[model samples]
Target: MTGVSLGFIPEPLLVALDHILPSRRLPSTVFDSRKFRQIKASIEEIGLIEPLSVTAMDQATGNYVLLDGHVRLLVMQNLGLVDAVCLVATDDESYTYNNRLNRLSTIQEHIMICRAVDRGISPERLAKALAIDITSILKKLSLLKGICTEAAELLGDRQFSSDLSRVLRKMKPTRQVECVELMVAANNVTVAYAEALLVATPVARLVEGKKPARLAGISPEQMARMESEMGNLQAQYRLVEQTYGQDVLNLVLAKGYLAKLLENESVTRHLQQHYPDLLTEFGVVVETVSLDRRHFAETT
Candidate 1:
């Protein structure tokens, strides 16, 4: 097999701030944003951790087009920095570097924090660098303490509140996995949803067989009803999940057939004259670009 091509050069180059040109303009309000503040604070506390991604130098001007790290560039400029390390990309296109980025998930963040602490980085120093409280840093360091391997793996690529792990920790490993799967399937992995799942969990499924605390304004009867409803929902979700692939295949086949059928002049004319609504509906199905849930809902 052929080797994969590298987008940027392996070694970073020291480029002057004046030699790097931003690809886009930043709004004035960006300076006051929380993200910008955090990035600035991080840079101030520990210096720039990530190098600026730039295109190959233009020999005419002896400058590089800044592909990524515009905010960092602005921060360094505000701090009166003259030079920065830059990664020189092979191509000038910034789409892949800018738009097609994978953000760190909550679990991934936790793992990195743990690794950093293990590598002798103090929680206080990390909190300062991240512009967060030391307590928050400690909380992130212990994010996966009671979470099961399976549940943690399920949430590896997902971004959710660190507090969600607190709710999962109350349940047994099997129940944690089940609840995580349910939350993932429903695409609602918030702390609130996790708490609801905790409430619906059977006492036996909880750690130490303890009952889930009653939520305020909800009586035992209402809680029981919620549990029953949650069970039914999970059952239905599993049933749908099992058949989702086959359903998609059938829809694709049907869409292709309808598209071909609508292509014939005689058939299109007959449908227009006798069954205009059906023809319109068929046209919608044929025109759908993807088999995603949103598209399916819109078509239906």
Candidate 2:
């Protein structure tokens, strides 16, 4: 016999909000947040972009248990909405649906806005639908204007601030790509990090020939030194990136082996008596999983 295939039914039905009950209660404080207000406005303007997820409470009764979209349901209830369209799941496993979803990234959001604008949806309507100011919508629309396509694509799925895009636009295409790569590799796409990268940028690689007055803290000589150091650091980082995965794997294996050896009292006692420092270092390495923090062994 083959295993049963189970998933949410593709067909959604309009279920009365009263009949579908929430599985968990939201904190009272959530209702007063700016996020809740935006959600309420978005629901009012767009009439629920994403439908709720629910499962039948009983096989015979039509009443359903709300699986996900708790905030959206609350918004609907606040607006005196009677019913909502919901995807019905065959089984009641709501945890996967709630936790395993990906929210839109900043670049992905920018692309969505651009596509909507191209599709003839005015920025005013978009602002109303998203419950944000028109100025915010315009910023999202202009997100990738001066950014190179390569860098834009690299950060497409990352949740970075829009201000980073502005900083990257000031650099030449090659420099822009390098900066994006560094940001992605480090998993830090903050405005401050982007500004640091821009500061280290050589004047020749800048979009404008002259240096900016905003970077007053760094003199021309200091900027030149930063550029040299950044180049060397990037080279070193690239070399580390090449072996980082395998290095981590090897470290994990070594830590596991050491942990097992230390589990034996005789082995641990022998190491403690003959090589106390070495045993302490091994213990520190076994405690931490990150190779980047291996300095914990040396510091101790």
lDDT of every predicted structure (CA atoms): 0.87, 0.85
Q: Write the per-residue lDDT of candidate 2 for residues 1-300, one digit (tens) a residue.
A: 999675678788898988888889999998898888888888886688788988865657767888888998999999999999998888767563665456888987988889989989899988987878998899899999899989998998888777787898999999999998998887788899999998988889999965678887777789889999999988998899899889988998998899899899999999999999999998898877655456646433
By lDDT, who's the top model here? Answer: 1
Candidate 2 Cα errors over 4 Å, as ranges: 1-7, 25-32, 90-97, 290-300
User: For residues 137-213, could you state the per-residue lDDT of candidate 1 as single tens digits?
Assistant: 98898899899999999998999988998899999998899899999887899999998898887777888686644
**Lowest summed lDDT window (length 10), candidate 2:** 291-300
Q: Clashing pairs in model 2? A: none
Q: What's the count of clashing pairs in each model shown?
A: 0, 0
Model 1 off-target regions past 4 Å? 1-7, 25-33, 80-82, 94-96, 214-217, 287-300
Q: Which candidate is the best by TM-score?
A: 1
